[model samples]
Target chain A: MRKLGAITQRELLSLFCSPIAYIVIAGFWLVTGAITIWNADAFGPGKPATLRDIFMWTPFILTILVPAMSMRTLSEEYRSGTFETLMTAPVSDAQMVFGKYLASLIFYVIMLAGTLIYPLLMEVFGNPDWGEVLALYLGLVLLGIAFTAFSMFASSLTRDQAVAWILGAMPLMLLVLSVYSLVRRFEGWQREVVQQFNIMGRFGQFARGQVELDGVVFFLATAVLFLFLTVKVVESRRWR
Target chain B: MIEVRNLSKYFGKRCAVNGISFTVEPNTIVGFLGPNGAGKTTTIRILTGYMPPTSGTARVAGHDVVKESLAVRSVVGYLPEAVPLYPEMRVYEYLNFRGKLRGMDRPRREAAIARAVERCWLAEALTRPIGQLSRGYRQRVGLADALLHSPKVLILDEPTVGLDPTQVRETRALLRELAADHPILFSSHTLSEVEAICQRILIIHEGRIIASGTVDELKAQVGGQRRVIAELKGPQAEVTTAVQKLAGIVNVRATADGGWTRLDIAANNNAQNAVSELAAGRGWAVRELRQEVPSLEDFFVKAIVDARVRQAGAKEDRR
Candidate 1:
C-alpha cells in the first residue's frame, strides 16, 4: 500500500510537472469534439444526440493519447536507471506493477472525465437518452483500463519512449484492423479466437447500445493479461 | 553483515561475474578496488537485490537476497553508479518521496528528511529544482536519498567519480562518519581513498576477487619481492660476481654510478644473511641498503597483472 502511494505520487508529480497532462487532455478533447460533431446526427432526421456519439470517439482518441501518456511510465526509469531504486525498495513486483498501472489508469480517467462537457452540452440541446449516455461512459471506463494496461506492457519493453509509443500503438492498431479482416477469413474456432482478442469489435457492441457480459469479460481479461506480463518482465530484470 | 557464496553471473556464454565470494562484517568500511569492466558494479547490484546471481546464494542482514529480498531491501540503502533521480523535483521533495517509499510516515518521514538533508549538507538546496543544481549538488542529493531511511547497510558505487577535489574530500569525510554506525561497501578505482579509510580491501580483477586482505598483506602478495638499493665503493665486476653467487640473491643489476648494485631479493623465500655474507666476502663498503616501500597503487596494478599472467599460464598448461 505504501509502495502504491509512492509510485502513484511520483508518477502524478511527473505528469503535472511538465505540459504532458495539459497537452494530452486538450488534444483528447479537441480531437474527440471534432469527431463527435462530425459523426453526430444532431442536425439531420436521425437519432437524437447521445453520449454514444461522444464515447464512440473516445477509443479512437485513446488509441493515440494513451500511448503518448504511458510511453514514459516505465521507460524513463529504465533509461535513467532509477528503477534500481524502485527494485531495491521493500516492494513486491505485483505492488510495483499495480502502482504504475493505477497511475496511468487514473490519468486516462481524468482525460476521459474532462470530455464529459460534450455530453452535458448535448443534454440541453436535445432530449438525449441518459441511460445510454451512462452506459457509454461505462464502456469508456472499461476501454481506458484495457488500454492503460496494454500500454504499460509496451512501456516495460524498452527505455526509449519513442519505441514504447510505437510498440503501444501497434497492437491496438492490429486489434482494430484485425477484427474487420480476420473475422471474415476464418469460419469457426479460429474466427472466435481472432475476434475474442479484438478490442474494437467488442467495443462496437457497447457503442451501439448493447451490453454483453462477454464484452466486459474481454476487456477485463485483456487488462489483467497485459498487466501480468508487465509484472513478469519487471521481475525478470532483477537477475540481469 | 553480508555473505556471498559461489556467486556467478553469465550473460549467454560470457561470464560477467565468475564464481567469486566475499564477506563484509558489521560497521566496517570495506573498499572494493577494481578497474573498469571488473564487475564491481555487478556485484554491488546483486547484493542490493537490484540483480540476481545466475548461481549460488547471498545473505544480507541475515536474510536471503533472492528469497527474502524485500526483507533485505528494507534494511539496505543502495546508490547505483549513475545515481538515478528525477530532475524535475526539488531536493526536499525527492527526499520526502524517497522516505515514503521506505515506509516512513508523517513525523518519522519529516525527521528522516531532516536528517538526510543535514547529513548530505543539502539544507540550502532543499527547495531548488534538482535539474538546476550542479553535479556536486546532485551527488549530495543522491547521498541524501540513500540516507533518508537511516538504513543499516549502505552500498555506494564510485560516488566520487566526477566530483572535484574538495567535494571528494567532503564525501570521504561523510563516508568515514557513516561507517561508525552502518556497514558500508563502496567500490572505487581510487586507491589512495581506499588505503586511507578502509580497514579491509577486496581487489577485484576480471570479475573475481584475486586478493582480499589488509593493505600490507596485499602489497606483500602482489609486490612479490623487496628491492634494496646499495651504494658501494669497489670494482663493479668483482662486486657483481660476488653478489651473483650469493645464496639469497635472485637478480642483481649495476647502477649508473660504477660501484652500486640494485638487488631484488626473493621476499620471504630468502634470508637476509646471504646479502651480508656476500658483502663481507667482497669487503665492499655499503652506504645504503633501504627497502623500497610499495604504495597501494603499485600493488593494485601488480595484483591485476599477476592475475592475468597466472590465468595465461593456466590456459597454456591446459592446452
Candidate 2:
C-alpha cells in the first residue's frame, strides 16, 4: 500500500505541476457553471429547485472533461520514456496502475466538487431536497471513477495523449448515446439487456434519489473492470 | 554477484540479445564494451527486471530475475541510456520518491536521499526542477536516483554518453569509488573510459560477447604477433636477412631511408634483445629499436571485426 501511495504521490505532483491540469479544471468549471445558471433561470424561483438540469448535463460534460484530465496519466510517462525507470523500480505493475488511477480519480473528484456551489445556491434561493442532492453527488463520483479508469486504460494503449483522448471519448459518447437510443427492432429480452447495460440507465436511478444497490454495483463494476484492464495492458508492455 | 546462462532476447523474431553469458563478482567494475545496437541496453534491461529474456536465466544478488523480479529489482540500481526522469520533479523530490518506491521509510528515505545527493554532487541542484538542469546535471540526477535505494548491484547503461570530458572523468572516479563495495556493470562504446575504469572488460558485437578478460589478456589474445621497429646505420638488405634468422622472429621488412636501415619485425616475444645482439654482432650503430604493444582500442576494433567475419563464415557454411 505504501508503494502504491508513493506512485500516486508522484503522479499527483506531476499532474499539478503541469499547466494542463489547471486548464482542464478551469475549463470544466466554467462550462458546467454556465450551463447550471442557464438551467436555474429556466427552473425559476416559483418551482422547487431540483438540481435536475445540473445532474443531467454532468454525464455529457464529464464524458469530455474526464478524458482531458486522464489522457496524460500513462501516455506522458511512456512518451517521455519514464515508464522504463518507473517499471524497473521495486513497485509491482498493479501498484503503478492503481496509483495512477487513484491520482486521476482524485483530480476528477476535485473538478466535480467545484460544481457543488450550484446545489448550495439552490438551497439558499429555493427549497432543495438534500437526499436528491447527495445521490446526485454520489452518482457523479461514480461516473468520474468509471471515466477515469477507462481513460487511463486508453492512455496505456498509446504514447500519444491526443490519441488517448480520442480513444477515451469515443466509447463514452457511444455509452451515453446508447442509453437513450430507441431500439424498437430488438426483441423483449435483447432490448432489456441493452437498456440494462446503459450507463445513464443506472445513473438515472441515482439522479432520482432512489439509491438502488444494483446501480451502485454496476458503476463500481465498470470502474473495476476498466482498472483491471489497465493493469493488464501495462503488464503486457514487457512482452512487447 | 551477477550471473547469466545462455540468455537470449528476441523482439518479434529479430534477436536483440543472442546467447551471451558472463558473471560479475562482487567489488569489481566490469565494462560492457560494444558498438551501437550491440545489445548492451537490452541485456541491462533484462538484468534489471525491466523485461524478461526470451530464453535462459539470469540471477542478480542470487535472485532469479524472472521468478523473483521484485527481489532482483530491490537489489539492483539501474541507470538507463536515456537517463529517464520526470522533468517536473525537483532533484531531491525525485530521489525521495524512488526511495519510497524501494520501500524505504520516511527517515530512511530522507537519509538515503541526502547521501545520494552528496555522492552524485547534486546538492546545489536539489531544489531545482529537473527539466531546467543541463544535460550533465540531468545525467547526475539519474545516477542519484539509481543510488537512492543503496542497492547492492549497479547496472549503468552508457552513463557517460552525453557528458563533457570533465564530467566523464568525474563519473569514472565515482564508479571507482563505488566499486569498492558494490558490483558494477556499466556499458560504454568509449574504449578509453572502459580502459580507465573497468577491471574486466567484455567486448560485445552482434548481440554476442566476442572477447572477455583483463585488458592485457585481451591485448595478448586478439593482438597476437607484436611489432618492433629497428633503425640501424648498416646495409638494408643484409640487416633484414640477418634479422630474419633470429629466434622467435616471424617476418622482417627492411627499408633504407637517409642512409639508414629501418627494419620492421613481427615477432612472438620481445625481439628487442635479438635485434640489439645482431647490431652489436655486426658492430653497427643503432638508432631505434622499440617493441609496440597494441592499444585496447585497436584490440577492441579487431575483435569486433573478427567476430563478424566468423559469424558470416558460419552462416555461409550453414548454407
Candidate 3:
C-alpha cells in the first residue's frame, strides 16, 4: 500500500510540475465556458433552471481531454527508460497501474471541481435543480473514470505519447459519437442494443436526474476491465 | 549474495543471453565485463528482478528471482545503464520517492537519504532538478538512489559511463567502500575501469561468457607470452636469425628503418638478456631492448577471437 501511494505521489508531483497539466485544465475550462455562453438561452429567465447543456457537452469534450491527460502516464515512462527503475522496485504491476490511474483520476476530479462555480452562479441568478445537477456531476465522474482507465491502457501499449493519445482518442470518439449516431439509425431491439453501448445515451439518463444502477455498474466495470488489461501490458515486458 | 545458473533470455528469435552462469558472494565485487550486445545488461536485468530469464534461475539473498521477485527486488539495488530518472523531480525528492517505493518509513527514509547524500556527494545538487544537472551529477543521483535502501546486493550497469576522470575515481572509491558490506555486481566495457576495481571479472561475448577470472588468472589463460622488441644497428637478416636462435624465443620478425633494424620477438619467457648478449657478440649497437607484459586487453581480444574461431570450427564440422 505504501508503494502504491509512493507511485501515485510521484506521478502527481510530475503532473503538477509540468505545464501539461495546467494546459489541459485550462483547455477544458475554455471549451466548456465557450459552450455555456453560446447556449446562454438555457440560463435565461423563462427557460428551465438546469445545467443540461453543460452536462450534455462534457462527455464529448472529455473524449479528447481525458486521453490527453492520460497519454503520458505510462508512455513517458517507457520513453524515458524509467520503466526499468520503476519495475525493478518492490511494487507489483497492479500497484503501479492503480497508482498511476489514481493520480490521473484525482487530477480529473480537481479539474471538474473548478466547474462548481457554474452551479454557484446559477444559484444566484435563478433556482437550479440541485438534485439533477448532483446526478450529472456523478455521471461525469463515472464517465471520467472509465475514460481515464482506457487511455492509460492505450498509454501502456506504446512509448510515443502522441501515438498513445491517438490510440486512446479514436476508440473513445467512436464510442461517444458513432454509437450515438447509430442509435438513431436502428429500430426496435436493434436501437435498444446500440443504446446499451452508447456512452452518451447512458449518460443522458443522469442528465434527466435518473441514477440507474446499470449505468454505475457499466462505468465501474469498464474501468476495471481496462485497468486489468493495462496490468497485463505492463507484465508483458518480462516476456518480451 | 546472488547466484545465477544457466540463465538465458531470448527476444523473439534472437538470443540476448545464452546459458550463462556465475555467482557473487557476500562482501565482494564482481565486474561483468563485455563489449556492447554481449548480454551483460540482460543478465543484470534478470538478477535484479526487472525481468525473468526465459530458462534457468537466479536467486538474490536466497529468494528466487522469478517466483519471489518482490522479495528479491526489496533486497537489491539497481542502477541501469542509462540512469533513468524523473527529470522533473529534485534530487532529494527523487531519493525520497525511491525510499517510499522500497517501503521505508519516514524516519528511516530520512536517515537513508542523508547517508546516501553524504556518500554520493550529492549535498550540493539535492535541491536542483534532475534535468538541470549535468550528466555526471545525474549519474551520482542514480548512485545515491541505489544506496538509499542499503540493499544487500547491488547490480549496476555501467555506473561510470558518463563521468569525468575525477568522478570516475571517486565512484571507484565509493564502490570499494560499499563492497565492505554489500556484494556488488557491476558491468563495464572499459577494461581498465574493471581492472582497477573488480576482484573478479566475467568476460561475456556473443551472448555467452567466454572467459571469467581474476586479472592475473585471465592473463595466465592466454599463456603469459611476453614480447621483446629490440632496435639494433645490424643487418635485418642477422638480427632476425640471431633473435630466433635465442632460448625461449617462439617467433621473430625484423623490419628495417633507415640505418637501424628492429626485431619483435615473441617468447615463452624473458628474452631481453639473450637478445642483448647476441647484439654484443655480433658487435651491433643496441638502441632499445624491452619486454612488454601482456595486459587484460590482450586477453579480452584473444578470448573473443578464440571463441569465434571455435564457433566457426563447430559450424564447419556440422557440414
Q: Give the poorly placed runs of model 3, Cα more than 4 Å off.
A: B225-292
- What are the runs in model 1 whose C-alpha is more than 4 Å off? A39-47, A181-198, B222-292
Worst ten in a row by lDDT for model 1 chain A: A40-49
Give me the candidate number with maximum TM-score. 2
Candidate number with the higher lDDT (2 or 3): 3
Clashing pairs in 1: none
| lDDT by residue for model 1 (A1-240), tens | 776898888888888786877888889888887877787565344566756555554666677889888888899889988888888888888888898888888888888888778767767666667767776777888898888899999999999998999899887876666675678788888888887876766777777677889888888888999999999999877655
The better candidate by DockQ, 2 or 3, is 2
- A27: Cα error in model 3, Å: 1.3
What's the CA error at residue B311 for candidate 3, in Å?
A: 1.6
lDDT of 1: 0.82
Query: For residues A24-53, could you state the per-residue lDDT of candidate 3 as single tens digits?
Result: 999999998998999987787888888888
Which ten-residue region of model 2 chain A has the weakest summed lDDT?
A: A178-187
Give the root-mean-square deviation of each candidate in angstroms.
4.8, 2.8, 4.7
**Candidate 2, residue B79: lDDT:** 96
Residue-level error in angstroms, candidate 2, position B69: 0.4
